[model samples]
Target: MRAGVCVILAMGALATMPWAAADCNPPMRPPANQRKFASQAVDSIIASYQPKFKDAQLGQIFANALPNTLDTTVFEHTTSGELAPDTFIITGDITAMWLRDSANQVAPYMRFVSQDSGLFSLISGLVRRQARQVLVDPYANAHQLEGSPPSPHTDDSTSTPAFAGTRVGAMGPTIFERKFEIDTLANFLHLSASFFAAAGKDQPTFGAPVNAAGQTWADAAELVIDTLRTQQASSEEEGGNPPYLFQRTTSQPTDSLQFGRGAPAARTGMIKTGFRPSDDAHTLPFNIPGNAYVVVALREAAAVLSALGRADTAASALALADEVNAGILAFGVVNHPGANGTVLAYEVDGYGNSYFMDDANLPSLLGIPVYGWTNTTDPLYMRTRALLLSKANPYYFSGSVGQGTGGPHDGLDRIWPMSMVARASTALSDQEVLSVLEQLKGSTACTGLMHESINKNSAGSYTRPWFAWANSFFGGLILDLAETRPHLIFA
Candidate 1:
């Protein structure tokens, strides 16, 4: 039988109970099998740390450091039930589905999916829900899935949902609120592609009968590609066409261009531009991270298309991927004194004027290796990574608690994000990895729960308490260490 069939059969016993309604309660006297798996996971994490924490004092310190359930107060809405998924929200302090966060949050669990059918089911359900959301509006990257009404405090009013014509799926009353963030969309594509590749199955909803769900996701991805090809910018109200306008009515202004009136060539790789990965508008956006993500997405999309027997679509995606990659290499790199050599800038003007600082998000210079864009040992990447993690990169900050990257989403001089720390550890040496682990263990305000962004000087004042991305990132890092360096645990 197929994987889905087998999963359904295994879950047959629990079918009568509302599995969806179950909170992420601590595993209740977990079965021997599950305890064994958890033990393996823990052991793997410890082993990975062995090379880093070999010092007798540090070893004990690290040994005492274990990842625990930070806050059970946060929950995910697995079904159209009353609860929400206990996950992390981004810096903006909104409870919603971040395409990027959702993917990264579940990444660590992929290893166990094959062995643990139940875990696989939960992940599969999340993917299906995301696919459905994409179909609803391919342009939007973030969403509010809880069916709650809009609040006056919302920043981007353009995304507010109306009751009519909204498609509610596994998660109830969800609406598309955040628009096309190339990075988030790219991550979504990557996750979907990876899941399909691993499971060796087409998306469960690919041809299934659902309320325009499959078509929506496919069309949205296509539209995103089209937008990138044309370099579409803001609507007339936001500032008309090409040069691009980035305006956030409620936050600190990042750009001065009247939306779409800047340099044209700089905007070449951009698609259907509106808000950025930070959910802020782009003034003259040929955002480096966004483009990088697009490149990755197109490559993955090509694979997915080919897998589904759509060779033509696959070819188109490949061509687009190449185009974006070429454009980025041509315009995104610059010689910076801060980097001590040529490095990837945060944002660039095709002619000149490249932004040097890094954002806390993935595709960041710090995240290149983590995102699998390049190997960690690549010379250019290593130099760039060193600069990004140092004081030279204006966004890099350190405090008594820990050190990591920060971004415009939060504020200047803010402490780094736990997400960045987790990602950094994935690509660092054993020594560096231990340093990050020590920092992370000290940075958490609520014992072990990850927060949005911590204060640069004070670890006590963190930005958000209920963040799923940070928790997921920490979990993912543990899994990575378990897989890559097993000795770190007990050494």
Candidate 2:
């Protein structure tokens, strides 16, 4: 039976049934609406696994497991005019739904959309909000509310208007303002395209461009793609009206260009003109993951354009995708001096400098297959995966709990991100997958709540407690295991 239908049946049962009276601290009965809704939600998840559980004894365990496994509530938004409540945000820990995170969070649910209208609606709402955010600022790695504008800052200045009162600053003076992070934009575009493709729908309820703000989001996405193709930067030299410049009020240098220009030495390649996927300023700029995402985005854009009947635009996007793929294969893959074999370098200098670490983000080495950028069994990907999951990669760390990818974004020697573990498992099998699962199950700091980054030695010393992406990722991993390795669960 369909999961949605099962949920309605469960809801009917819960509504008619009376709860046993309890002598607890203030005996309480949840509102009828909440009780029915929660029961329905639990039932929907349980129904998805009903095929695997036939015995009444096993069915009870399966039914009870639904509440613990369902982190769907973490995605909910409470305030008015905000995204839907079921749309997962990264909690108080990250404070934003990274375009990447939003995409991954809803990705697994796409399979069930046809079976569950409520779940499909929730996913659709999330995709619409994400598309709107992409339209807001394609170059931005993150964004705040629609009512707020980003603060302006310069290369040398440290003070800038906070986005939703959250501080907005980067590392060096030359890399002062956050540049358009190509990877994030690509991820957003990819997700938008994927949502349209999977849901078999066109654009959401965005109205005609009668107002400036109404047109701004779509306009920005076009501009962002154009900027990437043309290698545009927030520069005063090419007409001072670039919409991407920022200047910090404090320590603003005399030579610093206000509207979004970076320091002089920072500009390197066509790739050097943007920020890293991590939202940190790139040291060399020609970021591997960013370029990989560009390839994926272009491919996705081509499909979207074709779906819209823009054949010429689709062809152009496909051509760009091919070009990016060629560039990545040519420049991004290289032999490490110590590692002997070639691995995907993190960042590349047009002049031969390459960094060899992975970050815990999509398009990172760990997420290549998860993002559908490459096949998991591809020879280069297999080699790169081996390197990334090992101590040979500077970011890889092994602890008593588990071994997985880490990065400078959180701290040195941190264990694997739960997201990374989930992605890694999705890509591979055998001992590596089992080990990652074991570590991840142990790494949940708040009982079963997944965190951003956990310390290598101690499971409790995690970074973000409320990160919904990690929780959703863990939930996805569970679902994947249920589907792929049913025997493991039974065994």
> How do the predictions measure up, each by TM-score?
0.74, 0.72
Best-fitting candidate, measured by lDDT? 1
Per-residue lDDT over 190-309 for candidate 2, one digit per residue giving the tens place of the 0 to 100 score: 766766676674434222241235652244345546657655231323343333444434431322233444533222333334455545455555777777777777787677667666
Top TM-score hit? 1
lDDT of 1 by residue, 1-491 (tens): 00010111121222232222323112222244433113344345445664565443333323322322212212342433321111322322355567776677666556655565445545565566666666655555666644557632244323322355332222224543444466766876777677766666644523332243225345545655665665633233223322222233543454222332333444444443454556555544577767877777788877776767668767878888887788778777778877667887777656566777777766566776666666778877777777777877777886655577877667675665654563446455778776676566545532345567776555556666555556656666655565677676444
Model 1, which residues run further than 4 Å from truth? 1-93, 151-176, 213-217, 232-248, 254-267, 270-273, 419-423, 426-428
lDDT of 1 at 383: 78
How accurate locally is residue 214 in candidate 1, as Cα lDDT from 0 to 100? 28
Instruction: Write down the worst ten-residue block by lDDT for model 1.
Output: 1-10
**Candidate 2, poorest ten consecutive residues by summed lDDT:** 1-10
Task: Return model 2's CA RMSD, one decimal.
Answer: 10.7
